[model samples]
Target: MNADRTKYLNRRALMGAAAASLGLAAVPALAQDNSTEMDAPSTGPVHNNTSSFRMLDWRPYFSDTRNGAILVDTTSRALHFWSEDQSIYKLYPTSVPLTEDLTRRGRTEVVQKVVGPTWRPTPAMKERNPEWPDFVPAGPENPLGTHALYLSWTYYRIHGTHDTRKIGRRSSNGCVGLYNEHIAVLFGLTKVGTQVLLV
Candidate 1:
């Protein structure tokens, strides 16, 4: 099989498993904070430096226009943003990986947009990193670098991370990660209700 096709199959299998582990009907609406009622099964401890893998070479898939919402292709590691005219004009290569579990695969709605967003460690995250700050104020050091689009799903976000070298690689715990500058560009074009498709 082609490399892309093989990657897609692997992702599909992971998504299937995740969906089975978590009841499909119980999936909660996406929310801004990670403190939502729906709890995602613990996927083992998250490692901070999982981005050791090199980024694959992939061109961004984009719409012809720039006014619509964004859709991320986790398998291909690309982000597509549609325009008002129903064209996808902006595309960014992504390094973040979706959670391998099927429960994390599906459509989500962007509920909020924040620039220079702060990073707050969730209870789960805090457990893994005891030294993690209660909150990292927005700035160069913040995990959420310059832009963040909050999805309704708890503990998941489409945001800019400091790991630009990891773009086009599997790195994030479950969120869609982008480079700081790229996310800043995406932040300007997106709004609430932007549909996020993960396949």
Candidate 2:
């Protein structure tokens, strides 16, 4: 009976180890599929392009200290406006919509800044928003909102959007979307040579 009990215990231990190994082997396959899902493009047609969107009321203040540029943290959904002279000046919540396979980290310069900018959909964007006019005029109706900080990259712009609700969510086609009032403050703080660090 003693020998039988030892054999039974060993068999149970071996079964448990085999089960754990099977689970470990399955993990890589599941991880691979999850990555593939994230890489997929978002579905559905683009929504309305009207300026009926309400703008956020933002109040702006400046510090005498000159911070060099801006840093946008998409994961944390925050924007840090720093003065070159000081470590920090202002911080605002922001949002970025990314593709499933998208990955961006580190810093880049802001090459240009525009106020009340127009929206010119890229050929790819146009394909997605066929109903979108060739150019959207500047105003409350414009998706670009009241300010835009053009990044070093041609197509990517950090701009205010009429869609204020998107500020905390990952929802933009690719651009960084800010609240109208927050963007206006950012516009005042930054210039063509501003550095944008994304992490």
Candidate 3:
């Protein structure tokens, strides 16, 4: 293997170990294959923007203790933001990685929240697809969309995606992908250190 590839693998392994040690609540593992190849980000301009998913009553899915928690239901491809009383929740459709393991479940905190985040393909990603750019400046064309919520102590993120078509499907490299508009609203509601539970 190339030196760059070797380095990337090593770093990925270390990150995996760290996540496993973070004491995230373990959910029942899935055994079925869920691999779905992702197409390259669209270069064309986006138009007629609309979301296929709806904002619905989410009280049944939230807990009183987890008020303001970001609960991501990967199986349903949905994200729920709980209200102060856990009496209401706002729902948004999201895209997750095809491999269930790629979606880090359990618990993590929002370490950083950025508006218009730049896109940087990981070394491992670049190795697999040499056409991937090393860095993409923050903009409409960027895959990270308009806002990003970086999870603490891991490489995962709940971020916006330029490709709205991918929402409500298994189509990301590993991060949770949302529509640009949906993420913008979510970004405003979220704060640093907010708890996120992926299930």
> What Cα-based lDDT does every candidate model obtain?
0.61, 0.61, 0.68
Candidate 1 lowest-lDDT run of ten: 31-40
Q: 24-100 in candidate 1: lDDT tens per residue?
A: 43332421011111112224443233322112112243322233556676666777666557533566676554346
Of candidate 2, the 10-residue stretch with the lowest lDDT total is 31-40
Clash totals, every prediction: 20, 9, 0
Show where candidate 1 strays beyond 4 Å: 1-67, 98-103
lDDT of 3 by residue, 1-199 (tens): 9999999999999887875675322311320111111223633332222333334344454444343678787777878775555554467778877565555688787889999888777665666678777778888778888889998745678898877787777777778888788788778877786778787
Top TM-score prediction, candidate number: 3
TM-score of 1: 0.62
- Each model's TM-score? 0.62, 0.63, 0.67
Candidate 3 deviant stretches above 4 angstroms: 1-67, 85-88
lDDT of 1 at 108: 73
